[model samples]
Target: MAKKAAVLMLILFVASLLAGCWNRKELNELGIAVAAGVDMEEGGRYRLTVQVVDPGQVASQQGGNGGAPATLYTSEGDTIFEAARRITQISPRKIYFSHLRLFLIGESLAKRGIGQMLDLLSRDHEFRTDFYLVVTKGTTALGTLKIMTPLEPVPANKLFSSLETSEENWSPSLSVTLDELIDNLTSQGKHPVLTGLVITGDPQMGQTKKNIANIYTPTQLQYSGLAVFKKDKLIGWLDEKESRGYHQIHKGVKSSVVFIPCPEGGKVAVEYIRGKTNVKGKVVQGQPRIDIQVEIEGNIGAVGCKKLDITDTATIAKLEKEVEARIIDFVEETIDKAQTKYRVDIFGFGEVVRRADPKAWKAMKNNWDEEYFTHLPVAIRADFVIRRIGTISDSFLNQTKE
Candidate 1:
């Protein structure tokens, strides 16, 4: 009977502790920051703009407060932390950063160098590292944030979701995160590249609700070229074709459409379904050489060529050859620009060399960015195969004349 009484007493004690706890903050008292923009001011001051969601309105089915779903608070200071804290003057509650979805660094700030700001971003326990990072192409980070976006209630969510989509479906747009960017900066082998966004149309209209009221929004955000960085400072940008080549070299493309012109007629669209890239780096008699081999598998999505017959195996072989040439062109063109214009090894060829032979990499490490990379010998070979030709082998357009 005494043992049974002790067991009963233990159960009661455990139940009491599980019933309650302390240190809970009400949701109403916290300002949830969905997006953050960092920009450099005229006198080198740091400007912070945070998009805080209006909880009640964001959750509502009906339009809330003239269709404004979030509120923007801005402040400037000598440091990021100081600017962040100063914004509380306009904010009703403490700014909570745990939900941050997108982080924007202005082109001006990027040109100056972003290594210092990245330190604070990583050090803060409240900030999540997975949020997408981008450099605003033509405007301040604040300008991008101020523009209203369609579909997504929160403008930040629109940018965030679109970047995710673009990374998966598009070749030119590179989706970078805080952690990945930091890894590139801290590592000696590779430089960093960030996706660039530009605000389109009238800037004044973008900040208003009418921007989202029409079928075609007056202002929209576009994911443009990749922002090339020499260490932490912005150096140049890779155009669409060059960006596609960069992705190909890194094996970063998931799915993309390629357009190849017909020999005698119109263009044929091919969908790149699967691909493999091999970057082999070695030192040959104290000289560095990189051999790149790429294998591509694709399917014909659309054929605008009236005379080309894809049904014959010989015709398919010719098309495959064309595809291979295009792939090689992309790879070589990007390498040429990198060697001549940027003179930066954004492709991480140095890292590959290090993995293959540490001694060679060490010898080339100090001058890899400018001297060695500019003169590095790269040989590229690409092979493409058409796995399928979609549902119809020949388009009905083949029956029509030009």
Candidate 2:
């Protein structure tokens, strides 16, 4: 009887702890923000634009018939925090940022500095660091967000997917996350590079419902070149070729296409199979020098030259040498631009020096970027290998019979 009484008491205590939901929030009570854009307005204020998803429309099977997937709301204030709270005045539901996928900053705002905006994001509990960070080139961040995409009902989702795909396949642009940007801002001897986003057509038409009605949208968002920053402030931009070269030195290129001119009046396309870059810093006699070694392997993608024989081992050797030379040139050009034009160390060479020679790095850490990095000598060595020649060993263009 005593044991039975004890067991009953324990069961009653456990039952009391399993009460109703205390912190549960209804989905309808919150406005899910899929993307956020920040721009600078006149009078030293911030303009915040958020893309809030419509659950019913986003979840509907009959896509276009369900209305727009998201609606954009804008608010302006002296600070980002104030601007964010002001959004509640216009929005019916509470804005929630836990699901945000993209964060965009306008070119003008980026040039001014993004440290203030970054501070609020870092302190906010509702925001996550996984979302991609991008800069709107030649337009405001609000304009980029206004552009609607056809294939993906949600414009924010489209931007997120496009950024990932471009970074994986294309070499010109690089995606930077919130955490990575913060890291770059804090780290010494290195700067940050953000992928640029641009609106291609009429900005007004992109915000309308008719933007997604046709097979070809009037306005579209494009991933532009890389925006280079020095301590949270935008300094300059890198073109396609220079951006690719930066990727080569930074080991950002996963796989890309490289075209080399053939001996004949044609070109040979090679798909990058694999590439690795190693940067080492050395201090000799109080002088800094960086050695960059890159090893690349690729397969022949297309042969436009008819006279070039793919089966010949001599031809393959010559092509490999040519590829190596081209890679070296790319690295040199990028270093020159960084040294002479930007005068910023976006390559993280200071960190390399720090690790290699700590004592020497400590002495130069104070004025590394402005003094040492600008005049640092960089030596590039590239080795290339041709792994395969597509499906056939010999191209059909080879008319010479064995």
Q: Residue-pair clashes per candidate, as listed?
A: 0, 0
The C-alpha RMSD in Å for every predicted model, in order, reads 2.8, 3.0
Q: State every prediction's TM-score relative to the real structure.
A: 0.93, 0.92
What digit string (tens of lDDT, one per residue) describes model 2 on residues 143-193? Answer: 888887988888999999998887777787787889989988898979998
> Model 2 clash tally?
0
* Candidate 2 overall lDDT versus native: 0.89
lDDT of 1: 0.89
Alpha-carbon local distance difference test for all models = 0.89, 0.89
Which residue pairs come into collision in candidate 2? Answer: none
* TM-score of candidate 2 relative to the true fold: 0.92
Badly placed stretches (over 4 Å) of model 2 are 1-22, 64-66, 398-402
